[model samples]
Structures are given as C-alpha cells and as structure tokens.
Target: MVDSIRQYLSWYGFLFSLGLALVWVLMRIAAIARADVSRYFVDRLMLWISIGVVFGGRLGYVVLYEPEEFLAHPVRILSLDAGGMSFHGGLIGASLAVFLLGRASGYSLWALADIASSSAPIGLLCGRIGNFMNGEMYGPPTTLPWGVVFPSPGPERRHPTQLYEMLTEGVLLLVLLYPLNFSSWSRRHLGSLFGLFLIFYALVRIAIEPLRADNWNYQLAGVAVTAGQIYSLPMIAVGLVILGRSLSAARLRDRV
Candidate 1:
C-alpha cells in the first residue's frame, strides 16, 4: 500500500504543495503586518525570505552536513535539483533577510520576526510531507505496527520520522503559536512569539534526532549527541535571551 501510494504520488503535486504553502504563509504574514506597515512591505520581505530559504538552505546543507563533498565539487552547489536542505540554515537565512528588511524599511525587526515565525510551520509541514512521499528521512528499523518499509533503505520496516516531524514541528507548533499570535500580551511584547518558536522548534528537533537514521552522531561531554542537537543548542540560548528581554521590557512598561 505504501509503495503504491509513493509510486502514484505526483512530483508536480508535491512541488505545487510547497509553492502553495509558501503563498499561504506569505499572505498570512502580510495580512498581520499590514496593520503596522505599508501594504508592500510584507511582499518585499517575503521575496527576500524566499531567496534566503533557497540559498541558505542549500549552502547550509553544504557547510553543515556535506562540506567535504561540496568542497570537492564546487559546481554542484547550484544543483538544487539533487535535493539537500537544512532547516537550521533556512532559519538563519530568513532571520538575516528579516534583519535586512528591517534596516531598509525602518520597521521593527522583532515584529517582523514574530509574523514570519508564526507562519513558518505551514511550510515545514508541507516539506515533511514531501520527505515522506519521497521515502527519504525515515528512521531506523522498527517492529512497530505502523513502521514503513521505504524503497531506498532495503526491505526493513522503519519509523516514519517525517510524519513525526509533521506532527510536532508543523502541527503542534502551529497550534501553540496561533493563540499566542492573537494574544494582546504577544502583541505588546514583540519577539516573545518568535523566541518561543525558536525554543519549541529547537527542543522538538533535539528530541527527535535519535530517531533519524541519517543523523551524524558524536560524543559531547560523554553523552551521545547528534549533529541536529548540537545545532539546536544555540537556538535555545537565543530564544531565552529574546524571551527574557521581551518580558523585561513588558515589566518595565507596567511600572511606568
């Protein structure tokens, strides 16, 4: 059944879904930002973010995961058709784009970040589903009833880590952020939402790293650690800093 579904699933449909996800999230972010800035501000920001996601995701994959291979073949950097992307890299790229837009437009960087972070999960959800359809990013062999036998990794049944990501990072994050996005407290304390997003996503990524068969493993302070966990550690720290500042600013406002 799984093989049949994978075979019949349209690649075009997957691409379309990704495109659709981008459009939907961009529109939603733009709508939220419209109240604060000009109608075109969000549009321009989204364009930069799109560029960032492509370049940053690609470059990140090269720098972080496959530096040796990409270094050997510099020409392959442009070959995005080969399929390699890193979400951490994409986040960094998007954050840089947001910072650039903020500087150019004289807008609040934190506000823009909150808007982008709120809608990011939709794109993630679609991307994970695409991973599943391609039978990539599956976990180690499993005996569970729901274990999937992917085509590329032989006949052994494996955990559907892609679906797990979809549920946690995509759906769960969306649900958590949706209410916060609309809350008055979040509006007053800009950056809190974005901070929470970073924290939550980093934690989830770390939690699931052990399940991913392809993750690079290492020893950190005698603890078994994956590359994903190492990359995510900084996000937690940054999130805490941002969240602390937001709350501190809010408290100061109350005293005034």
Candidate 2:
C-alpha cells in the first residue's frame, strides 16, 4: 500500500493535486456556508486561483531561488518535473487571482480572501509533509530527542523543519481559524480572518526560518538573514495594516 501510494504521488503530481484539492475544498465550504452564492461563480474563481498558484509558484521559484539556472535556460521554467515552487509567490498569485475574480463576480474581495485563508492551512500542512516525504528542506543539526536523520543530509540528527512548519503553520493555523470559521460575526466582518491568517502565517515563517539551514541567505546592512524571513517581514507589516483597518471598520459597523 505504501509503495503504491508513493509511486502515484511523485513531486510534480502531488503539487498539481494539492492545489486543485485545496481549491475544491475552499469553494465547497464557501458554497455550503452561503448557499445563496452562485456555484458557477465559485468555479470560475477556482480556475483562476489554481492557475495563479501554479504559475506564480513556478516563476517565483525561478526568480527567487534559481535565477541563474532560469536565465541560462529560460525554457526550463516550464519543466515542472524539475521541482521548484515558492510559497510567497503562490500567495501573491492566488491573492491577485481572487481580487480579479471578486471584481468581476461582484463578490466582496475580503470575504473571498477570508474564505480562502480560513482553509489554506490545510494545504500548508500537507505541503510540509510532502517536503518531509521527499527528504528535502531539512534543518540544521540538533541534539533534541525528536530530531530526525533524513537520508539526504547525512546521518546526523537534524531538526525536522518540515514538521515544525506542519505544527506551527498548519495545525496551529487551523486552531486560530476555528473561532473565525464558526462565528457569524467573524464571517460578516470581512478581512478579519484574511488578515489573521497572513499575520499568523508570516510570524510562523519568520520564526522557523532561523532553524532551517537550507534556506537561501543574503546579506543586508551587514546582517545575514534568510530570504524567507526577509520576505515574511513585508507580509507581517501588510497584515497589521489590513487587520487594523478591518477591526476599525467592524467597530464602525457595530456602532451603526
């Protein structure tokens, strides 16, 4: 059973399926929650989101992680089997997709964002596991009892950063989303869940970057920091702005 499962879900195939599955789940949840929303509109939005994530992730990976290789062979960017994707890039793409779709469909932008954010942790959780299974993105050596010795990084025990991401970015993310998911007030208060997800996920990514030895590093103002952490800082600031505005608006609505 295990061998059969492994054979079917190779890296390229897994990523393709993951994006589609998450979109399906997100649209289904939204449909169930607001039965009045047109299912056909949801389907159109899903197509955009899926395309955004795939292309965005791929291009971002090329630009951020492998600019030289991409420049040398520009056509290589289309090679999905080579395996490179960026989470931040995909987020950017997906957000843009939603914004455009919302504008066309006459749906609330933040409301769509909130619905997607509430459920995206499931994809993050699964993605981290995919990383672990592929024996990629392991962390530096650690003496902790729970450290794993992945086949790629030699026999030394290392922090399983993938699992850490799964725990912090995935399970804990779901926990934070739980209240927003069930509360009627939260649903009506557009952007609350959307901002919360960005803030929480950004914080988790920044915290975890330090533990990841394989992360891309660059020097900034005589200080060395991982690229992941650098990218997350902007997300944190943006999230704070969105969250503050959303809260203020909700308060104003309540008063009225």
Q: Of the candidates shown, which would achieve the greatest lDDT relative to the real structure?
A: 1
Give candidates' CA RMSD values in order.
Answer: 4.3, 3.7
Each prediction's whole-model lDDT (CA): 0.81, 0.79
TM-scores for all candidates?
A: 0.89, 0.88
Please give, for residues 151-181, the per-residue lDDT of candidate 2 as tens digits: 8679999999999999998889977884465
- Candidate 1, residue 223: Cα displacement in angstroms equals 1.7
The prediction achieving the highest TM-score against the true structure is 1
Model 1 C-alpha lDDT per residue in residues 62-94, reported as the tens digit of each score: 898889887898876666544468888988898
| Alpha carbon lDDT at 125, candidate 2 | 80
In candidate 2, list every pair of residues with a backbone clash: none
Badly placed stretches (over 4 Å) of model 2 are 1-12, 34-36, 80-83
